[model samples]
Target: MSRIGKKPVSVPAGVTASVDGQTVKAKGPKGELSFVVNDEVLVKMEEGSIKVDPRDDSKDARSKWGMSRTMIVNILLGVKDGFEKRLEISGVGYRAAMQGKNLQLALGFSHDVLYPIPDGIQITVPRPTEIVITGIDKQQVGQVAAEIREYRGPEPYKGKGVKYAGEKIVRKEGKKK
Candidate 1:
């Protein structure tokens, strides 16, 4: 009785979706993406919508049913509108810039950290302290942002480093006098 799996995922007007065996593919104006549903889950198209169900009543099957349905939904939405992640650098000399097809970061380091942009993903620096990552795949976009943030994560005391936009950092008290 997976509540989310019971709900069908509708294909938007401009997006096309197909389910072949365990693989679900979607194509839209943004781009194309696909997800492979687990064998424990059964997927099919019903009246322009995708439906998912567990193959059995076992715990594993039921667990995968909801996850598979969410994965299908992610691809459909990904291909339709894409995804974006924003990172902010908050140090005195920390900044980000686009160097050709790579992202150059100055996170209070002696040398600039050069991160090569991957294919199908776009990185833009609207401002020196702001980094925007966009891609058709939600996972890739999020992974790229995480990798960049790992270079110089925000500290608890001063919170001087790179962090996600609107992320709240828990500050720690400074050394007592």
Candidate 2:
């Protein structure tokens, strides 16, 4: 019933995967990661690949089947190659910098917004307007990026704020007499 669930996830070189009950754990050059699948979804490893299927034909089980499979695949890839997110800061005087272990943001505020870097996650400011967040755990990397972007999300008017790279913001027109 699920196309994605039907396909097996192959284990890449230099990476190891194991299945325990409803959880799949992967260890690789990047780091180690694990995903706990839903009870309705069954997970197993075979022939150096991971397989997922629904335990029943019910709607809830079917709905979690594809998602569970995808989560397993994400953990495997994350352990092998890790994940990365890029953010771009726009507008005058708006920029980002790293002070020790904290990310300092200048977003037209009265005070600089400081964000503490979390363990296992790396935050780099290659340029004043460019922020790169990298981590072996996809969820953590995305959560950190979201937190950073939340500080000053891009606005429609003038499109001035923090936004994901390659993100397009729909511009809003100004009022005229």
Candidate 3:
């Protein structure tokens, strides 16, 4: 028996879960997400919980049973609570500001870099040097954050660039004299 697969996924308030053949859909306040689980994994919706059961005892079926359950659970949570990533500018004159739907970044370059924020992702500037990324889908939020951070990655010498808040950069000595 798979422990994780046997666990019951509780239905939270304002969240609805429905199983249709091989696909499962979860709807919450933030948004709605659907996942098509493996055919070998038998998913059943009970009174207020969803259960995943594998049709076979094979290794592959057992693994998929648990994996599919976890994926579906994450989608449910994501639609209910969402996800957020916070980033900060770490240079003398590096800063970020919201210009309409675009992010204006001044990263000690000759000209400011303008990054157009993607749809379904929200960018907020709590402070001049701080950036907050929020969205329902974890993958999209992370991808957008990575793209922004790549514009001016943290440097080892001066540790100047865009990075996640509280991230540590290993500073290196300029030269060996």
In terms of lDDT, the best-performing candidate is 2
lDDT of 2 by residue, 18-122 (tens): 999988989999988888889898888899999898998999999999998888888888988889999999999999999999999999999999999999999
lDDT of 3 by residue, 39-147 (tens): 8888989988988899888888998988888888888887899989999888888899999989999998899999999988999999998999998877789899999
TM-scores of the candidates in the order shown? 0.98, 0.97, 0.85
Candidate 2, superposed: residue stretches over 4 Å from native: none
Report, for every candidate in turn, its global Cα lDDT versus the true structure: 0.92, 0.93, 0.89
Once fitted onto the true fold, the runs of candidate 3 whose alpha carbons sit more than 4 angstroms away are: 1-3
Q: Considering only N, C-alpha and C atoms within 3 Å, which residue pairs clash in candidate 1?
A: none
Most TM-score-accurate candidate? 1
The global Cα lDDT (0 to 1) of model 1 is 0.92
Pairs in steric clash, model 3: none
Q: Kindly provide the TM-score of model 3 when superposed on the true structure, using C-alpha atoms.
A: 0.85
Checking candidate 2 for backbone clashes, the offending pairs are none
Better of 1 and 2 by lDDT: 2
* Residue 33 CA displacement from its true place in model 1, Å: 0.9
Model 1, 45-144: lDDT tens digits are 9999998999999999999998888888888888888899999999898999888988999988889999999988999899999999999998899999
